[model samples]
Target: MEQDTLDLAHISLRPFQLSDADDVMVWATDERVTKFCSWEPYTSKHAAVDFILNITTKFLWCRAICIGDRAIGSVSVQSYSGDDKARAKAAEIGYILGSKYWGKGIATKVVKQVVEMAFVDLPDLVRLEALVDVENVGSQRVLEKAGFQREGILRKFLFLKGKSRDMVMFSVLSDEIGA
Candidate 1:
């Protein structure tokens, strides 16, 4: 499936462009930003841009979250997760914003919009999950605020920041996501 650029009346969601690399690198590659994430800090701008483009190209739906015009970060909902792939009716939501934009409620708001898009725009999708690091309390709150219920913990589900880490799973089904 091809990636579709989604729009939210005020905050537009589009594919990542090469120009976003410099600014994205400044924040996304910081140790503080990737501290609890499942990946290491990128050393160069090309790495960041290529990473975004590579993932965005494969997913059916991915968004470069934008505020006004600047691409502030990314929000992606893949067609399915490992176990959910057999269900053929679920998607997993993941996102990241630069550190400067943290605590602004922007991530929560954008995530809410993505939830709405999944339930309203996609007819076949039944649910969406947010896989957040167990230690990322702030992000867990964001998922909760966005209406995703805590499903459970994924034990040693991902190797991030040099070691295996657990993840708290949150999910919102189609029927539960209000339009």
Candidate 2:
């Protein structure tokens, strides 16, 4: 609903807009950001912007992470409806940041705000889960800093870069809020 920029002092999270497509292109296509991410390198600026515009209107939860006025990363959630558990007011989250910005706590801060927003925006949203590639230790740490717990290792649970990769299932339940 509200993709307006969110300011939490050190970092800000905003909606991914058509205008941000150009800024997004700088990192979205980089191997460091796309390797473990859901999508692959964008072949062109137009293609990148097209994707950003589409993501803006396609889902209930999506955002562009910004530092100052520049787009540095992105985070989003996809709804699951096939199963009772999947559709019980829950969704899976994913994210990536440019390698140039790595080792900073930007991702952690953005994730925390997004998780809080998810719970507030959707009252029944009892849980938010993230499937992190097993080798992505930095990503795992981001989830933990955001208050998500690693439930288990999902063996070959995801396909990445044309191969089956193990993933760590991390989640945060409603009852665990502020715990």
Candidate 3:
């Protein structure tokens, strides 16, 4: 799918631009923001620049979660790699919001929009999943509020920061949405 922008009541989801580096660095470098994330806290703007240039640019579905003119976070739906067509139809969703926006329901709104986009814009998509660190109750609430069902725990699913961690697997199927 082509890169597209989405407008919600309070936020706009748009493609990341070179100018977004500084704003991205604001949260990306914060220890509080990276604590439950898979990657380490970005130590410099250069790292955020590299991420915007390499990773975000490679995915058409990666979006900067913006409030008005500023980007405060990101959301993405990436298809897993596999030769099988069925595998290609399934994608994983991930998101991060700045700590200041944690309890205002922004994540849930962003997630619901992205999930709708996945089913409507990406015709091949059949399933979308999110794996949240088991200890992150806020993120778990966000996923559940967005209509994702907690399937199970993926034991030692990821090596985040410096140690292996368990993740709670959550998913929302196309047919299961709005039902």
TM-score of every model versus the real structure: 0.85, 0.88, 0.91
Top candidate when judged by lDDT against the true structure: 3
Give the alpha carbon lDDT tens digit for every residue of 17-37 in model 2.
777878888887798778887
Q: Measured by TM-score, how close is model 1 to the native structure?
A: 0.85
Task: Give the per-residue lDDT digits (tens) of candidate 1, residues 1-179.
Answer: 01133334556688788877776787677888778766688898778877777857877688788866677778887786556557678888888887767777778889988888877777988978878889899999999998989999999999865788898989999988654
Best by TM-score: 3
How far off is residue 144 in model 2, in Å?
1.0
Superposition error at 55 for model 3 (Å): 1.0
Query: Backbone collision count in every prediction?
Result: 0, 0, 0
What lDDT score is found at residue 112 in candidate 1? 89
Residue pairs in collision within model 1: none
Least accurate stretch of 10 residues (summed lDDT) in model 1? Answer: 1-10
Residue clash pairs of candidate 3:
none
Ranking by TM-score: 3, 2, 1
